[model samples]
Target: MKILGFRGNVDPASYTLSDALPNFGRASGDRSHAHSGSTAKGRDGADVPIAPLVTIAIPTFNRAELVEKCVRSAMAQTYPKLEILVSDNASTDGTVEMLRAIDDDRLRILTSEENIGAIGNFNKCIDEARGDYFVLAADDNYYRPDFVSKCVRLIEDEPGLPIVIAAYDVLVVDEFSKDDRRTVPARLSKKLSTGIWQGTDILQEYLHGRISAQLLSSLVRTDILRRNGGYSPHPCASDEATWIPLLMEGRAGFVDEPCATYMVLRESLTEGFTADKRLGDLREVLDELSAVTAKKVSDPAMRERIQQLLNRYLAYMAAVNLVIYRRGGASLSQAVQKLWGWRTVLAKCSVTDFLSTWRLRSIVRILSPQPLARWMAKNGFDQWV
Candidate 1:
């Protein structure tokens, strides 16, 4: 009976949403005549099949304002069969109160007794999901209406594919302009022109430091996820660093349409987690991933790609530490620590590649980006970088 209002409309529930929302009734009608059961309307007012029950699982800890928009986005999906699950990590805020007031039967709220960390909360969401496929919806980001439907079609069409990655628009909500949005379509061009990378092209790209897209861009197959032992337990890039290798089991397909929007936060772990001591944690995880991928994958090509990716990550880590030193985030002593640690990994890699990255970084530091980009372009280091 309590149909709360969202951002834009309380004017009139369009015919489709009106029927879908629980206990729908006209403003003037008798209060007793509310429609309760699921009845989805098509574009021309015909009833289409209700979508397969989709569980959009969100892991939350505070950020009440952001979670509301995320829930609204899930509710707005054109697909009829959706169940929104919010797994709260025991926040002291009024997050629970805010959710309790929402009158939708489709939305389910799950909570932890105490504050579990984000990784624990996420794993709980996965364990609780009943949908044939599970979508990891972050508290801070949201999806377009077609997200579920498009992904469902992709997975169903090629049921064997372990992951269906939809193109997503990166929304740098804080500082970046809308013009700065990047598209993350699976690149066939890279597959061909780059030649067969490591073992699998996906692994190769990941090894090459190219799999930096947001987690929201991916809708993972539940079975494949479970088989791989879920989220990475050791506290470093768990969302991304874990999922990329799991998806590497088979080819990753990309949908052309933008399904989700990632709202970049200044304090987002992907950015700040690489600071201070956390960088060491991330480096350890990357190292573990490299070792595991190499041992597990049967294909020699994949192992090579995984090793190359590990090498590239070592190089990137060195570059990042150098930047930290230049920007005063790290002391000369800390920079020395990083250089000593990472240079060892670099030493294991091909000398040409190591020298190329070192030369490129020095060039960038000396000259402006324009000249650096031009010079790198002149050499083939542009693509490798």
Candidate 2:
């Protein structure tokens, strides 16, 4: 069988990728004889149960070189029955050609004639996916060999389960030295213990500043996601925005283990913007998220509570981001003044749930003089920008 968008059939069993990429074979290989039927290799290399087809729809724009790792990670999954699509947003930098060179029959290179913006390209991936389950992995992050297998069984065991979120590690790279990289595990709230997560519970906990990670790299039941408006297109808080509507559909699942890697680039978070994305203001982003919640939730009381929580959460996060944004050479005093302006709101938010060890350090980190951010990071504090 040919990969999704490309023509011509080829035997996947004999298809071997180039040996030159930095860390090539570490990724998992095809299951069974040729991935024609599901056969997963367990952590012990023993066979585990396998299931239906899964589509990993990766959206990309340029960065042909960097995306190699991401694609290789998807290709390495131990779980069988897969279709991988690299949704190229009409990149002129040879992105499509680079992906097409991979000989894996399961790999497909879907290109747009014109450059669609990030949101449009993301939606295009969802619309074009044909698998029973779908995963929209960002081109920057890599997945563990068991990422799909980890969550798929849980989701499939419970028919109609909207989604399953696997905890991920954020790859934090030192700004001055590319080689100095650390993986910080994104912790989930104790309130969201591993197992079944109710929709309303997720909605409330997430908005109340309880769940610290994100919903971006979720393993979603394809039909449920499409039935509920796909991913939310909000640029600023699109991470949470995408989850709000889907959670409204029903209860979901959560696996606390780190299955995928979430890249925390200084250029995007600390340095204010990346080559392709603009780090929008958190206040405005949360405002848009509140509006999204209002539309999805039916209860008036829950809506008001969530909005209030979001505002408080906003004050806290914005303070953190402001502290982080200052790393981009922003004036310390002026930024402090901006943070000081939210003093009352921050105080209220802090008294309620900011006593957590990390939260306390986050407060200390933000209030810290501009020079101390790095020191704090080195001292076991996650410098989440």
Candidate 3:
């Protein structure tokens, strides 16, 4: 048995609770940074404390090498007050051994006796996190060194600030490479316009499906996450469930540059529509959105519109995939059967969603020859995805 303690990064003198909190019996801290008590303006015009402790929780499993890179990037953050918690979900590989070799005082590895499942591990990271602010980072993704410092300054605590949007690079790579090396050209991923991206009206954009999971990597408030029930089994929109309320009720932040690199395996990116779980995911997403909308949104009109958008988005996605799949090889009978299944879901969708240029181009690509489709995608088609 081995023990990796938490007595390294946290400084006791700088630690304080707002009103009340459940004590996690953390080890005493000794660190270089101390709170100066300087306050900064939040998005809501209220003053917020600066230099608070930020936790970078990397919930990882057997991807030892990828997680090692993630840990190193986390350690390289320019933020002065930071703690890196790597939760090892009973990995059989050299992940624990690899984590043990890291010498940073900020790095603390929490080992589970048995696999707690991914979502369970995610919530566990939040439950065990000791920072005032938190980031539930993906184990395979690596961040820019200034990822923390930049996002930290933009944080405004109106309460429950779920995510700070940052422009990130998407590195499509081969999953089976001896090296988890880059496979395709890297491109920047964007959600909305930069500068003060969150406010009262942001909820509509969120419900409209503009804030997809690709933008999930960002700084978050610790207590807000726990109060929102952390992560749930939305399997479809797990990130959205935790982040939407806070994003809607509170505020949001966005950095115009790359804070981290989101690594997507080339196979996942290039695979056929039916080959992936997207249709099922989209259906599940609709179910999840209905529940979230009913609970978080107040206005009846707004909730109705949200349902329409959700239905439309689902219809567009399913329709696009169906068209592509049918053209690619699936028989007419199969396509009709799939369409029959989606009929109820599509009935609620607006025709405008189906007529959008984004959808049209996708359909044209699949209908075109392989070479032409590839050329159109690379040349002028809105590969904004």
Candidate 4:
């Protein structure tokens, strides 16, 4: 597989916080209206005031074009005291030049002399943030103009809410035809009422796929995030690692509106993963989460339940990997051999569990000839694999 966009070889010591400090300049707009002592109704019907500052951190790699759109979207936020931070992960794609061209005073550009990988860049964003609330915006994603305003209102209304997970729309740009684009609301399990929820409740919802863990969809409290440690170093599931722990520590607010757009790039890190590699990444994520849960939860029964949940999740992922391998042209025997040897996958379930967890049709597809499986996928009859 091709390397992820931000994982280029570069010395870690080359970039420091001093290199990324922003020069303060007056932004063009009169943001006074944004800070107008606005108050919104809380979950308990009491008036709550908005926080003073909101920071949006965009950690970008090499996507110059997409990064510009992301920055523009962030700059368009209606929130009054907003700061737009662009942490360039030492891009050779003219991303720095593009950011420099933007005249908005609210926009701050931070340059790294060398690539710091995605996780490092993300943590750098957190370290440099100076707002009461923060949003880790992806370079490839764009937000609606009111995204921040709405999220801020939610958090402000629900005092003590550490994070607010908003709904987002998926923007799928056709690989072959860039003009043929489709925008669809992300399919969430259920529409939750706007309110503050317990950390365990949200975690349960996330584990059940009722809520999304997308970093772009979340608005976090800066201090809470720092106390828990920013994003994890795990390449694939850092979002999960960070958000789950933070949610466990405090209450979370929910916003039902689809406020951001996640662009599905063909060559992006997520799409580039092979079935085996994807499964491995999931295993690493589960292991990290399991360790965190075990350390934090004291009840033996709750710990056992979490373990069972982990095993079930692993089973689901293994089944998905089976489908992915088949879609990647792996023969039945090759797929089985590769999956069977994975220790984490094996530990999740026994042979009987694996057989019973997946449906007969799914197994048939996994075992089908490569040509047939490819034809089915091409015809759009099999979309999930």
**Per-prediction TM-score to the true structure, in the order listed:** 0.67, 0.74, 0.73, 0.77
| lDDT by candidate, in order shown | 0.53, 0.59, 0.58, 0.63
Question: What are the runs in model 4 whose C-alpha is more than 4 Å off?
Answer: 1-52, 175-184, 269-277, 298-302, 350-385
RMSD of each: 13.1, 11.4, 10.0, 8.2
Candidate 3: segments with Cα more than 4 A from true spot: 1-48, 156-162, 175-193, 197-215, 267-281, 294-308, 319-337, 368-385
lDDT of 3 by residue, 269-333 (tens): 32422423445655665677678778767779877777776676565566555644543556657
lDDT of 1: 0.53
Candidate 2 stretches with Cα past 4 Å from truth are 1-52, 208-212, 272-308, 340-358, 379-385
Model 3 RMSD to the real structure? Answer: 10.0
Which residue pairs show backbone clashes in model 2?
28-76
Cα displacement (Å) at residue 238, model 2: 1.2
Q: Name the best candidate (by lDDT).
A: 4
C-alpha lDDT (0 to 100) for residue 372 of candidate 2: 76
Candidate 1, 1-385: lDDT as tens digits: 0001110100000000000121111112111211233434422243322333567888788878889899999988886667688988787788989998988987889877776666666667666766545688778678889888776665444443455555454443322323433222232223423111222555454445333333455666554565666655645445455566655564555554557765543223123333434445556766777777766678897577667766665555455445433333344556567666665445655665556445454435323344453354334343343
Higher-TM-score candidate of 2 and 3? 2
Worst 10-residue lDDT window, candidate 2? 1-10
Find the candidate with the highest TM-score and give its number. 4
